[model samples]
Target: MGKNRLQLENHLFILPDYLNHPFISGNKLRKLKYNVLEAKKQKKETLLTFGGAYSNHIAAVAYAGKEYGFKTVGVIRGEELADSISQNPTLTFAQNCGMEFKFVSREQYRNKNNPLFLNQLKEAFHNIYVLPEGGTNALAVKGCEEILEEADAKFDYICCPVGTGGTISGLINSSFKHQKIIGFPALKGDFLNKEITKFAAKTNWELNLDYHFGGYAKVTDALIAFINTFKLQYNIPLDPIYTGKMMFGICDMIQKGYFDENAKILAVHTGGLQGIAGMNTVLKQQNKPLIV
Candidate 1:
């Protein structure tokens, strides 16, 4: 399942089976593997990371920490969850995985790079290994290199959605032979090309920013409807936030004659299907039928 590809209409290819790997089950898993290994190598007793309320990174860190027997701390963005919380399945699962949650205000969380912030966290948790938010550290990039070896195929272009740029950077660096490696940013106004090139430095690949329909986490009725129809037609589920936007942009580009008919496009399905839970409620409230 690691080398999966689906030739969708208009020359767009989807690699849905990338989600099947135990360690590479999702983008977060791929990013976490190297970080966890590094923490072990350094003999770190605790793993400290940052993420939003619904972050996949938090979930991945929790699972990885448990597997590695390292104490885990999640510097969660936003207010604390209620005493008897019901929503946020991922957070609940992370808690169950033995991750200690620390809530910080949005303003304080934004100071992630400040020395004071690091000192404070260190004071609270001694010998803690800090992983950047979303696991967008150098180690994460090194970890992402495995993805290219996993997908050993010759293709004109390799595409994936860009968030913090770790996955895209890692893929681009590892896929030096690929003709083009494009990153479609899900965030509408995000300057991902600049961010990617800045973080990855002097890469020999084209960064395409033509796909974001609106902005990060932004979904419209048309987008939701497209996800539903696409799933019904192909029996593949896509979360509205990430892969759905990426597939939408890929097909849109194909229809617009962006790629040659013979072009071999490999769309990396960076899995985050767990996000669909929130969208499901929205869809049902709007009386939209579930595709599956």
Candidate 2:
């Protein structure tokens, strides 16, 4: 089958078909494929994972669990929910997908690898499979390998937003000999480069971490306006948490003459469209218009 078309300013090209699956879409779907298969190999009946209130990983795990007939448990990193309470949109979506939720204190949650924690969870739910936050595991890396294979042509530069660094790491690992991979981090922190280096060291490719803009989950008015303008011009949706920052960084670098005109850049649009819901609150709090 041919690649899907996405019209962008000054050019039109085929975009990867990441929306074919209802629950399994975008980068999350790409990362979860092998994780699910590995779970099956281990004969695990339940899939347990960790994430914040609006984590895409949590939503994907919930959807995958229900789709594959496995029980799912989400260990939330925050305060406990009261009975008969209304949930946030993300949590509501997960509940509708038949995933169980468990709230835990931030301190206790940090001990995710402690035997006592695993044992307690095992006793509560037998035959469980534990997936790391954002599904950043070796199995997820294997699944991400499929992304590089899906690219229609070789590119000089491959760009993607870095969150936990799993997706970008996978892209770097799967890069062709001549391709250079760069990760635009969405979070601000000194440790991101270190993390990327650690992951990249395991692979044959190196990662460039200079395009984070600000930091992870950190959005400025300029970034928001840029995202709005791009949507108006391209009519393609981008979540501020990742893809938006990636596009912003790419455009900035291009204008600054970082890329040669002959260089072909491939930007991975890792979908997290559900994150749009949170933008309403941010805009209202900032007294900004909802529309571009």
Q: How many collisions per candidate?
A: 2, 6
Best by lDDT: 1
Per-candidate local distance difference test = 0.76, 0.74
Residues 18-41, candidate 1: write the lDDT tens digits.
466543256787787888888889
Candidate 1 to truth, TM = 0.88
Query: Which residue pairs of candidate 2 clash?
Result: 186-215, 186-216, 187-215, 187-216, 188-215, 188-216
Candidate 2 Cα outliers beyond 4 Å, as residue runs: 5-17, 80-87, 150-153, 197-214
Q: Which residue ranges in model 1 land beyond 4 Å of their true spot?
A: 21-24, 80-84, 150-153, 199-210, 281-292
Using alpha carbons, what is the TM-score of model 2?
Answer: 0.88
The residue-level lDDT of candidate 1 at 220 comes to 78
TM-score of each: 0.88, 0.88
